[model samples]
Target: MQRVIVRSSRGALPTAAKLVAGIGLALTGFFTASAILPYLPAGTRDQGAGLMSMSFGWLIGWRVIGRAPQATMAGAARVGLRAALWLALTVLLYLGALQMMARMLRGRYHGLSEALTDVIAQGLGLGAAAVQLDVIAMLFLGGVLSAILSAWAARRWQ
Candidate 1:
């Protein structure tokens, strides 16, 4: 079984570029969602869901690389780590852009406390523990979506 897995991964070597492109495409999707969704109706955006989706997509990319023909478990792990790094970079860039936009449009954010409160509200809502569960569930759903896509890409590209 292990040998079979190894052989399958080995066959996926030529698709590295494809994998990278897919990740890029996924990130583009995430940014697009983030930029446009916030402007919609109050309940429509669901920032927690968006975050979850991105996280899932990132994991999908990792799994795709892992299942590639030439990839070993270690290689797959590395791919996952790299994907995570890229995800972090993407988040930082997005947040920075948001801050810059906010500064230009509004002069300043009211303060850190206000920002924190807003974040908490978005993630945890007004209800007690229910909001937290919703956020977690949304995030999990996002991850599942990402993993499915990544795995599909890997299989298709191979």
Candidate 2:
């Protein structure tokens, strides 16, 4: 075998860390907003949380992914798409995890012989609950804000 050298992209940790941070902020923000805006609709609270978190993710992705803000308009669109895609993927995974946890809590499907259809149906149902427009829109906006804020933070600190 030929000699091989392996190196990992340096941005991976920052990207993952930022994703976790953004998720935490979204959850905390939702709870805080729920308490502060007692009369706010559940949907509105969820939208606000998504907006805040996604904007943060956008900034994080900007810094981690090297899509500079000074690029052409098309470049900016690509950056936005990148962050949005990340969010979509994350949402799917998270929903799937939640579905699995819910099933475990019910103590069902513990056998190897269990039909895969049951699992797929459960996952799909949870996924459907997660794909609201307001949620998607806020996630996009949050991603945009993340791009802006991450750029600003990098400028200030680095």
Candidate 3:
């Protein structure tokens, strides 16, 4: 007789699809809170939050698709195309999600039009400059700090 059993990979996902989805969610949250939140006023927090969430999804697309492991030109091109498609889809979904969330949180925003305008204006004003700087800084800091800490933690944990 043959028996079947399912094995767990703990918190890890085996497939690329699952891994990308998980990374998208995590990066969205991290980018929103750590990078985008502080730049916005309280009333416009939701808008910034939404946009940041979307941006992270695109970032994940770039990471997964555009920056695949070094390989043949054809393989690289395929990965690039896939990444671009995923990035575009992620942006669209993010916008849709933001709109839905805005409707759900209608009461929280005093006026949709005015709040949106303010959000857009603020976004435009600091979007290109401050946000980019923040992203770069955060990436640098997080990369270095995490690497050091991860090494330390691994040694200790082992």
Candidate 4:
């Protein structure tokens, strides 16, 4: 394989913007957890990944509504890609925090293989202290609806 160098021509993120985004993302997780966890079935309430749906909603809300709808096809596609990327970033941050909390609460985890197995099993066995897809699926749908409403609000008020 050949190696290639990559460089960013665009400037680094502004300090104030970085601070705001970090605080916003952190708050998103906290807000989502506080608001949604109690309503979830007891089995999957602790899994913070579910918070991504709420994060997605808030991120997409601004991205989708902030952009002008009259853009060219390519521009629209670019906006969509950015929206997807925002969701991915949100998921990573939220899950990373959750994993750290889990480790702190549970003490040291086992080897890599065991950790992976535990994650998979937790995903499969919500009734036994793990994540479940069904809950996430519903949460994601709720997020989409939330994004739409937020977009409407953004457009109407801003």
Off by over 4 Å in 4: 1-48, 109-158
For every model shown, what is its TM-score relative to the native structure?
0.35, 0.48, 0.34, 0.37
| Most accurate candidate by lDDT | 2
In the predicted model 4, the residue pairs found to clash are: none
- CA error at residue 100 for candidate 2, angstroms: 1.6
Candidate 1 — worst ten consecutive residues by lDDT sum?
122-131
lDDT of model number 1: 0.44
Error of 3 at 139 (Å): 5.0
Prediction-by-prediction clash tally: 15, 9, 0, 0
Computed on alpha carbons, the lDDT of every model, listed in order, comes to: 0.44, 0.46, 0.44, 0.43
Candidate 3 residues 37-89, lDDT tens each?
45544444345555554566445543553233223445434443444344434
Error of 3 at 136 (Å): 2.9
Consecutive 10-residue window with the lowest summed lDDT within model 4: 13-22
- State, as a TM-score between 0 and 1, how close model 3 is to the true structure: 0.34
Give the worst 10-residue stretch by lDDT in candidate 3: 142-151
Superior candidate under lDDT, 2 versus 3? 2
TM-score: model 2 vs. ground truth: 0.48
Query: What does the lDDT read for residue 38 in candidate 3?
Result: 59
